[model samples]
Target: MSRRDFIYTLSATGAALSLGACSADGGSAIRFGYIADYNGASLLAIADKQGLWKKHDLTVEPKVFVNGPVQIQALGTGNLDYGYIGPGALWQPASGKATIVAINTLAYADRVIARPGINSMRDLKGKKVGVPEGTSGEMVLNLALQQAGMTMKDISKVAMDAPTIVSAFASGQIDGAGIWYPLIDTIKEKVPKMKEVASTEDMHDHIFPTVFVSAAKGKAERDRKVMKVLQEANDWRAAHPKESIALTAKLLKADEAKVAADAAHVKTMTTAELVAKTKDGTVDKWLDGMSDVFVRTGQLKKSPDPSTFYAGDLYTKAAAR
Candidate 1:
């Protein structure tokens, strides 16, 4: 069967099989995948569960992935229309393949937790630190090390995903780590001696998770739709933080307190407000800080200009709306 025939067959099969199919404008449908380890990233869940996409004339079939890299890979391959996730996974795509449509949530919501005997950054030297490679958690940890006049070389770095890092910590294989909620909260509760030593605080305006909504292949126009959906969702979140928290927490299977804490960490910004902040070079300062940490630690070959990767069309449209 041809690709079109296959899509039709699949859509029919979904309808017949009782699984929902993608909904699109005037007969167009789009697949939108999300990560299930929601934590505070469940803004999409709230929008989805409440049928917000339908109100926008969209048939976004939301699927869940296990991690950011997988979710982003799906986005890059045309398997997803759009999703909310951290910008760290956008580096390669931002180089040429895709553009970040908008900022989602920017909260440091990430912190570094150390073992009982590890009391300071100085104590971390020669100790093992576990982090999911290429994640904001790791990025924050790298920044913290640099701020303390140290590098990853000063400590043994264990590259693993969130679950693995947690397991390693539990097994006493890693001395400390930079982690996000609810795992961060879970770890603290489970490990009596584990303590948070630092967070994304004092990083200037860089304290929130900058979510990216990527465009599908040959779908630049759809980027506008993604942005609109995100803007509406953000507005909903702002007006109903409690409802957002309850719904998101239910979907993520996390506690209300943890979800609320995560929400509190996010100082939501309007698209226009974010652009204005960028105009004043606050984003530049944040990226510069990120670049400095990467360059100093050899994560980046050189400090590239931050502006090369940003796309403001979505923000511009959202502002106009």
Candidate 2:
């Protein structure tokens, strides 16, 4: 097979991923930076609550950021040994320099809620929608519109975070809004007229949701130990749900009740499941679908090789033993 094709093939099977020629010998302490938002924060919480670092013979320091962009910037600066973030946020940085190492969470928890009178995406035309511009919600909104044969230009894309979106949506500043849960739940309860119109689930398959990526040059890439630790952490979280939720609440400053509710919605897969699904037809379908949407929405210049951005070996080796 050609080099690119070979890489894609191996990535599909979870084997023979390309790695730099250095050893990851001494880097045992890993600094995992994440966002305070639900998804990113949950990952760190899972690791800590499950004692994943101890299980893997490593020390993990989790740092919280405000958003995906800031988290990606931290990765690029060597401030983070690893992190979880929305796949949409990685487009610019991955194209520029960074490399995504593993698929952390394949299922996206983002949901779109529209006011009662607004039933279909067609109704969104000329309506105001709240989303953090250049975020996963915004990207998903673009895709949802495309699926309906529409575009962002068809509606007003208002820039706001989840909290602001919640408040504005309540006051009718926006006709529709996109946010993740418990916010989605909270908003729906507060605005009884609001209803869910679309969700990441409606898109059909995993859109890589949020991924685990490292900088072009981080110890996670060079050290097998670091990779093993991360894998063990994944395994731990897969085994411990309650503790993970509690830790998640502490870090997010959210209620334990809501944190538990969110945990049910977050389907954290094992390293083995990730390796298998990503290796076969599953990951191919996701990447192809994502590429189509990105190209359609002008998010990408051209179709670049998605496999080039992945390091399948770490996940592969972790799964092997």
The prediction achieving the highest TM-score against the true structure is 1
Q: In the order shown, what is each candidate's alpha-carbon RMSD?
A: 7.3, 10.2
Whole-model alpha-carbon lDDT for candidate 2: 0.64
Candidate 1 C-alpha lDDT tens digits along 6-59: 111223222221214545456456665554433324557666766767767776
Please name the candidate that would achieve the greatest lDDT relative to the true structure: 2
* Cα lDDT computed for each candidate against the true fold: 0.62, 0.64
lDDT of 2 by residue, 106-170 (tens): 64667777998999888888999998755677777877787778888999888886567877988
Clash numbers, per candidate = 8, 3
Give the least accurate 10-residue stretch of model 1, judged by summed lDDT: 1-10
